[model samples]
Target chain A: GAGVSQTPSNKVTEKGKYVELRCDPISGHTALYWYRQSLGQGPEFLIYFQGTGAADDSGLPNDRFFAVRPEGSVSTLKIQRTERGDSAVYLCASSPTSFPQYFGPGTRLTVL
Target chain B: GIQVEQSPPDLILQEGANSTLRCNFSDSVNNLQWFHQNPWGQLINLFYIPSGTKQNGRLSATTVATERYSLLYISSSQTTDSGVYFCAVPRGSRLTFGEGTQLTVNP
Candidate 1:
């Protein structure tokens, strides 16, 4: 079976620019999540989606970060006016419901 | 919200050695997981033990929910086992990950 997959394994952009990272979850997974990881640190939760609606998004750092999981299978994390502080590896995971979430390869975003 | 802590922030070992990593949570959790983030930054699921014990190959995990802690054991580790090991527990609808333990296995 196919695991989770993320597009643009690496992305480099200038500060104040916008970038969108995509994630394809495993087949039949009803729950999805997004997280960000800085160097030498663990991943921090960004958003969680149960089905098409975001169940919890408190982890989103600010209003500039938004994520959508339309149709409950694919998700896109959008960063508006990105800042150098946003530079990190963006990770995505999916699960049937919760617990034991399977992770993707992640998209490394670099804000220069 | 729950606080998760990992012990022995950094560890170094020679190939074929065995080691144990621990994770302690401040509150009770219904879910707990262990992951290995490789050099390429891909997080690989190692165990999903919220309680009890389970083993896979040279890796095994045990979670004592009542004690609010989990332990991951790696036996006969190889250089490929060198990476960051993380433990995460669910808080509300999201996971709260610990800072992780950096493991370096030398050949």
Candidate 2:
């Protein structure tokens, strides 16, 4: 079985630019989540989607960060006017209903 | 928000040795899980024991939800076991993770 995966394993961009990270969850998964991990720290929650709707997005740092999981399988985390402070590894995970989560190899985003 | 803490922020072990990692939470949790982030930065799900115990090969985990803590034990560990081990608890619909215990297994 295929595990969760993310595209563009590494991305580098200038400050104030926009970037989008993609995630492909396992087939049949109904929940997706995004998180950010800074150096030497644990992952911080970003947003979550149950089905096609975002069930909880309180973890999103600000309005500049937005995510969508259309059709309940694929998700994209978008950052607008990115800042140097936003540089970190962006992780995605998926689960079935409310079970334990399986994580993907994160996309490392570097804002220069 | 529930606070999760892990002990021995860093550890070093020789291959074939045994070790135990611990996680403590500030509040009761309906969900608890352990994860291993390998050197390549891939997070692998290890266990989802909110209570009782579960084992996989040389790895086992026990969670005493009533006591708000969990323990992960590794027996006869191998070099491949070197990585960061994390424990997470649910907060709202998201998970709050611990800072993780960095393990280094020397062959």
Candidate 3:
């Protein structure tokens, strides 16, 4: 793809329901990242992947929040028992070898 | 964790005006970059300046790695330039973005 792509630009789910957000990064990006942004706040790191392995998952709020980049090209962020506080914009980004990252349009998930 | 802060959380400028936005980090960083998030929520990379100054036509950026700060300068602001500007730093494979400065350029 020409740029990073995220599915379900907007999502509205009932509390406690599980949801999965997907990301398709640039064709050859070696590093991928996921961020969460609340209204009026900057994006916060949720997880990072180097190839198919998750190099860091320290940013995940709790065990219920998980993400995986199985093939090194596409990634999925899974949330279990979603809470109303979980409502926010989920952002996915990718980078080749540099620190500069390219971001997706983001999925605005609303837990109601 | 790196503490990234940007000044003037909100900025309003008239078309053709010039302005500068500042970002400060609490810790040392190996790299820094700027991005412009449009109304549609697409983040577009603007600069990859860890140090020194780089200019791209009406826009320019300067980062003083030693001072742990960076500045983004917008010259001849246009209505289309109205958006949120974010500065992020390399924190391992992840980049920590600042709170972002929302710039509104009115024609």
- For every prediction, compared with the true complex, DockQ reads 0.89, 0.87, 0.84
Put down candidate 1 lDDT per residue, B59-98, tens digits, no spaces. 9999999999999999999999999999999888788999
Per-residue CA lDDT of model 1 for A1-112, tens digit only, reads 9999999999999999999999999999999999999998899999899999999998899999999887889999999999999999999999998867999999999999
Model 2, residue B78: displacement in angstroms? 0.8
Per-residue lDDT of B6 in model 2: 99
- TM-score, prediction 2: 0.98
Ten residues in sequence with the least summed lDDT for candidate 1 chain A? A93-102
Candidate 3: where are CA atoms >4 Å away? none
What is the fnat of model 2 with respect to the true interface contacts? 0.88
What is candidate 3's lDDT per residue for B1-107, written digit by digit as tens?
A: 88999988999999999999999999998889999999988889999998999999999999999999999999999999999999999777788889999999999
What is the C-alpha lDDT profile of model 2 across A4-111, one tens digit per residue? 999889999999999999999999999899999999999999988999999889889999999988788899999999999999999999999766988999999999
| Angstrom error at residue A98, model 3 | 5.2
True contacts kept of each: 0.91, 0.88, 0.97
Worst 10 residues of 3 chain A by lDDT: A94-103
Residue A103 in candidate 1, Cα distance off native in Å: 0.4
Q: Is candidate 2 or 3 superior in TM-score?
A: 2
lDDT of 2: 0.94
